[model samples]
Target chain A: MGGSLLEQLPLFLSYSNVSFLAQAFGVTVALSIVGCVVGYTVGALLAFIRNRHVVDVLPARFLSVGFSETFRRVPFLVKLMVVFFAFEVVGMRVSMFTVTATTVALAAAAFSAEIMRAGLEALPESQWDAAESMNMGGVMSLRLWALPQSWKVILSPALSFTVGLIKSTSIASQISVFELTYAAKVLNERGFSPVLSFGSLLVLYFLICYPLNLYARRLERQLERPRGWKSGAPLLAESEAA
Target chain B: MHYLEIDRFTASYDGKEQVLVDVSIQIAKGEIISLIGPSGSGKSSLLRGLMGLLVPQSGEVMLDGEKVDYTNRKSVKALRERLAIVFQQYNLFQNMDALRNVTVAPVKIRKRNAREVEEEATALLRKVGLGDKLHAYPDELSGGQQQRVAIARALALKPDILLLDEVTSALDPELVSEVLDAIRILAAEGMTMLMVSHEMALVREISTRVVMMDRGRVIEEGSADRIFDNPRTRRCQAFVGKILSH
Candidate 1:
């Protein structure tokens, strides 16, 4: 009744076609990169739109709040299925890759817009006052002072969200997009070995996401300062001063 | 003519409460006008009104006989370039080092020569006695140092009038004097300033004219010597007595 390493080795080796797995892995990565970059840009723009109290008329405010909320409430799987299938109803035929990437990007933008809004709001009013007094009010003030301070608040969460998006790419396999998970499913179907094929797939995902998690944690550590003092000696001190 | 005139300015935060009511003030060239009042007395509202950070329900700020149209963005921006403010909290830009914090607005917004602005910023930092801490971020500096950097940044704009809103109020007791000392230096050099301060001693020493405010109105206006020594109103006398005793 004991499981032997020798028996498992052949099962794993039998499905290891270098070219096929490599192609699937490449597609999965490309999808995630495209999703995150486009997602963050759109999300940042949405954050700005939602924050526009200066010119905030009723219609613009409602539209921004409504769109972000709707996207945030919808589940990613449902969103993906809707995009993949619904377009055909309107006489539009989009690629499986395009559909998957678009769905992930939309989901990511909703989440990130909220994160960026929170980050921007956390800044003190004095930051704006100081900029305005120096004749640097409006968009110039937001760009130079407010936005830069918000990056530390935005970066770690954004990166963690990106990792989640990468994992969620496996869902795209349901559309038969032939990313990593779909590749594993194909191998398992052919070889009649569920445990070996799926376990290796798990290992491959861990390999992709672990370093990202590490980097995010490192960034978080850099953000913490004790008694308003950052780690390490003061960067540039006059020789005579304390 | 008054160099800067604030005529019948009124300000409120929420509709329910009036923070400042029909406040008028005038300053000649090179006058250090200090606004002294108890908390919630609208000393800051007056300064905010002057900076165009707060819109007045009914009032006007005139600079050198020209009416400033606060509603117009171009007018306000042009007005603000001639006026700079340093807050009680310092509000230094944490993203950049000390030198860059002072240099950013001049180079970016004013479209000034970067090299010229950098050199002037360096000189300004040295004037504030931060000659050695040019590259230090706000987190790395003490409250006094950060406040000093803020002062230098304000000076870099070359404003015709400087507004300081309780600049030293946020500092630790020991740190307050260093910031006050920097202000003292500016006063000696004849910088025109309008300040809201609770530091009576510094205010008395630095102000050419001092105004006492209460309940959104100017209660008393006189020379600093008279206000501190012989206050006319019961409120001014009581306020001065209470602060001096402390």
Candidate 2:
């Protein structure tokens, strides 16, 4: 346990499947981007539906609640299995990439809806009144004013969700998606040490997610500060003096 | 018939317990009326009802001798477009600068040309004494400045009437005068206004007529001098006494 893991890392590098690593990295990055885009669109639609008062009426209410609960409560692996198997059974014949992207997006959409709803809820009621008094009608006010403000509050959570999404793509390897985890698994099975292969995979995830986390935190701090308090000395000195 | 009439109006958050009970009021063209009341006396609700933000359970709201139809979407839009509201909270759009907050609705909803809207917004902001703060966001402005921007936003549409719901309540005591001063300018220009305020001095100075509300009912109303100097009802007298002493 005390020995340097980097020393043992050469054994894995010696087997040197550079092309496989490159393919895995490309697939992982592609999957994350596609998944986040699809997730954000679906999440925004779901949030709109859930937040709408018209949905309180009958089947829509029940369906929305059921959709939210089912997607949120079910494990992503089970969702992956259902999606892959169902598509196969229906003679749809999708690639493993399609299945993984769809599953990750569906899972992320459920979580993102809650994040967006929280952002919308955090806005003051007075904003709506102001918009109305400006002669801004229903959807126009929401599109122009409310959503822009909501985006600021939702930014940090949305970034965190994207990081989770990058990690969750590993589970796609179980469905033979050829992402980073699959490459690691193949290397481990081909006589490379399990510790080295898995360790490298962990490092790759950290490299992807750590900077994102830092940026999100930085944004959160920037937004939390009162406006006009950012000039170098006098503002800081005034705040401190107060 | 009055230009605006709210007859036998009653409203409640929950339908059962009416917050504004059988309230009736009338405003003639180019008139500025101030609604003065204690907290929870339903001044805001009455204003909201007239704006069609709240539907009175049983009442007739007439605009220019025609019944104002609250249920019809187009009519509601027309009515709302003709009238504007300024809130106690200075509900200026936080993400936008003062100019944009004033110009957005004109450009988007009213479909006015962007250049013309900007010019109009700038002029209105200047009128409210916020010409220098035109590019500043609401969060970047002081409370008084934000309220003035709110006033500019309301004025941009050039609505037939402006409803002010305790517009000065959220201001610091020292800041209240700045907002009241802007409002006084609007009144002096003969902008028809229905102001719900707790500022007795400002109300006395600016309002042509004052209506005092108590327990959701219009307890007293007359020329500003009559109501301010010699109250007729015990409720009005008590209300005025409490406010004056404070």
Candidate 3:
């Protein structure tokens, strides 16, 4: 009297089942947003410190570069495991969710710092001269002039990294965090209907990630648009009446 | 008192090859001193040193009898407040429109009233013949317009001396005159200027003093008429002869 797989599809895709998945999806989205915000702020500060050569002492330079380089070279999953286990060994007693989010945030911060460093380097040396000639202080010059231009170089990669970070959060299931993937794993084990179960999981991730991918593409197009073309200034704008 | 005096200033990039060697010059108020030299002859580097863009290997810069201490933040800040530079590259902030480029430093760094700064920026833009392109970004404006905006940006600071480091060199031949026109107007207004230029004709016309440099030293320097027409050194004569022949 076993029902067909088709019959099981409705059971898995039902309102009650969908609601459960939605709740877990909500957690994933919330964690990603918070991680990204915290990560980006930390990353920007790190970039500023490094870019300004804030501390010229050899030890300070070595430590800053070493810290960032280590995080960048290490695999995210390995770093996550190490951080989680290290906290346990140290008897921190923090919640698994907190540890996982912090690890992701740290990882994201390191990457964004690297991205910002490259963006800053791409700017011309004359830019600093221009800023200095105006009697602008270092921080003020960086905020008003340097960051705005560097952000143009940073935006696309950063958004794309965010999408990847969202996907990577699925790994949180291993840490026993109640995200969408955890819910999916639980349902798949109970039903043993891998097709319907994993298929539904796929749909949920697609729902979240597809939009980001599309937006990233749109942003690329918008950014690549010729400099003055952003406001859709007409052909005659260049030759406008004096 | 000299408005600006560069005494025995020597500058180098890597401490290996000197860019400016014992270069000394004095500029009076309202004087347009044009630095003329062949490529790699340290014309721009001299201007940069005056702007505090380079550290002198030895020697000092004095503005109005006060020593400019490039190593001290406060002194350099004060030095910059009175001395602004317009680079050949324009170096306009690409993120902002022309008006913001002119207003940002004044309002943000100088802590001037924003509204007043904006008003002055608007007027400066107009004076540069960029009144119509006030909102244009650096990349949107033509090279001529961008350079003019850069000049306007420098003017926003109300500097006592304006350093023009080959400001028109990067412009196309047709676009060069627009930027030069802006500088000419500034000159007419009696703005104190130290310019490094290759436009021999324009330099001859506008300069109060002409300095000729070769191999990182000032070989000949005098009144524009004397340096161009009645040069003293063989180096200056040959330099003028080649330029005049062309």
The candidate that wins on lDDT is 1
User: Given the true complex, what DockQ would model 2 score?
Assistant: 0.28
| Residues forming the 10-long window of minimal summed lDDT in candidate 3 chain B | B107-116
Candidate DockQ scores, in order = 0.34, 0.28, 0.34
Write model 2 residue lDDT over B1-246, tens digit each, in one string: 578888888877656778888888899978889999889998998887777666568878787777877777677777888888888888877767778788777767777766667788888989999888877888789999999998888888888889999998898989989998899899889999999998888888888789999788898989889997899998899888888888
* Ranking of all candidate structures by their DockQ, best first: 3, 1, 2
What is candidate 1's DockQ?
Answer: 0.34
Comparing 1 with 3 on lDDT, the higher-scoring candidate is 1
Q: Where does candidate 3 stray beyond 4 Å?
A: A1-3, A14-16, A53-62, A224-242
Worst 10 residues of 3 chain A by lDDT: A229-238
Per-prediction interface RMSD in Å: 7.8, 10.5, 8.1
- The residue-by-residue lDDT of candidate 1 on A1-242, one tens digit each, is 13565675664564455567778888888888898789888888788777753234667657767878998888888889888777778888888999998888888888898888888777886787777777764577667667767777887888898889899989998889989999989877766366666876887788889889999999777765312222113312211132
Q: Which ten residues in a row have the lowest lDDT in candidate 2 chain B?
A: B48-57
Worst 10 residues of 1 chain B by lDDT: B11-20
Query: Over 4 Å off in model 1, which ranges?
Result: A1-8, A11-16, A53-61, A222-242, B14-16
List of clashing residue pairs for candidate 3: none
Question: Sorted by TM-score, highest first, which candidate order results?
Answer: 3, 1, 2
**B1-246: candidate 1 lDDT, tens digit per residue:** 998998888877654467889898999889999999899899988888777777567877899899999778788888888888888888887777888888787877777766677789888889888999988889889999999999999998999999998998888999998889899999999999999999888898989999999998999999999999999999999999999899
User: What lDDT does the true structure give each of the candidates?
Assistant: 0.82, 0.80, 0.82
